[model samples]
Target: MRKGILIFTLISFLLLNTPVLAQEPLNNIDLQPFLKLTMNVTLVNTGEYPKFIAVNPTYDFKTFREGDEYLLHNTTDLIQLSKANLILNKRVGFWIYPHEVLKVEFSINIPMDLGELYLQDYADLCYPDYTITWSTKRITYPPSLGVGPLCEVVYPHLINYPILVDLTSFIQVRDPEIVIYSYSGEVEFTITNRGPKTMFAVALPLIPVDAKIYSITPNPDMNYTEYMGKFLPTYLKSQVQNAKFNLTQESVLFEYTDTLLSTMSSQQNLIQNSITTNEDIVDYPIWIVVLGENSSFDIKYKFQWEFTR
Candidate 1:
């Protein structure tokens, strides 16, 4: 019995000291760039005999995109992960042996197409208030209690905020009509405010080359369309020419300022006489006071050529 015990100890020492050889079938676990956007993982059976193993990651096995290509670790042989039947059940082939690691490398590509609408939603879904989750777990059969078998990993990553908010969701443009003939025409359209708060001034930026404004007026919508045109054509023709200053590349601004009021303080004010209540405060859609949250209004821009064609 003592001789038998001595032989066992000697065999154990040799096994411990001997380095495991790389076999023809490459029996070993493999991972590429362990910290990567798409992690390549596989389990190999280094032993000559077949072994049963399974991966039970916390993530749903089917979450991977379809048609992604996988490989048998070091071999040129290609495999399609989506075609693997066992993966749907979150298990590995009972016969998976040396050099074969199940490929879990895949990217989730979520595309947004709604332009500014997408930006608005992205801003609301980013950072401290929201977090997306990803996790994984592993299980091996022929269970050895507490020896080496089960494992789990999970985490949450933060999203970028400042860049997403700068996108164009706050300003909206719609239904514009411009007809110019012989260097004279009218530009009309309604701009809507889609922001959370009130807006002071909105830019109308379109002006014909060397054109002098004839008149600017607000045509009320169906709610109050019966009232006569709120602006005096003769008076507005002058105010607009003076106030309709343009800056290259920037939008033309239609502003209501007290600076323009200084000239009329001693005379009858067009704003006080022609423009009274909030209805007249902003023409049809262009707001003078507060373009309250998400409101639509209109502005009529009429112009004539400074040098007649």
Candidate 2:
């Protein structure tokens, strides 16, 4: 029994000293740099196996754009994400086997008809068995967990601030067409703040751009000092080029939200704000400008009209 115990101890020591891997463990799990994707191509085998997509999965590159540049997005759904959001899910594959090297050989028809080329990637370090190596050997997986999966954007320039603000209706020129009619009607506005955070109150507006000449005369919505509760210099109506509404101090009111808010929760806050109406009754106008597709058809903001002429 003593001899058997001694043999067991010796074997345990040898096992502990045994090398687990031939080299080192690669820890980086992101796949952006090593990710090479191709669209539109014909297959040609190099010799036996010139290239092998390591994860042991079969993929067809034949359906890709043969010579044209194809844009790559990081989603499996293949849809675009907002410019504000940059992170993408993993979209890379690798082969397994700790020591065996497999290769897939194929000939590709590289025609000049293709435009620019770009690629997006991610690595899977969940299992240490997966590995991908290229001839240049420039790309690598970092040996740490917290290392960034360095994201990149590549494509033609396009839209900005893309968001779906939903459908809303406005009654155009209630009193009268200031330029054409004798009377205009009032378009009562009640803006609702659906956000948990206090909807940031800005100067005249939280608009995409500011007006140069701005407001001139105080009409219906253009009454900068009256409609807009705060006397901010940046108020667009204050500089207005003005409308024709006879101003009244008591006619204005302060509302935190819209009058008939459909999809917001701040109805109570705005209702409360309306109660103490002596000083802050005045609120900013909902200024908007409509233009035709033609660049020549541009106009300054048109405020809601009540009546004055």
The global C-alpha lDDT for each of the candidates, from Candidate 1 onward, is: 0.27, 0.22
TM-score of each model, in listed order? 0.21, 0.14
- Report the alpha-carbon TM-score of model 1 versus the true structure: 0.21
- Model 2, 22-99: lDDT tens per residue? 322211221111111121112222233322221111221111222321122333235332222122234322221233
Going through the candidates in the order shown, the clash numbers are: 11, 52
lDDT of 1 by residue, 96-201 (tens): 4344433333221111112211112222211223222212234333333343333322111111111111001111112111111122345443434344333232
Off by over 4 Å in 2: 1-232, 235-252, 256-269, 272-281, 294-309
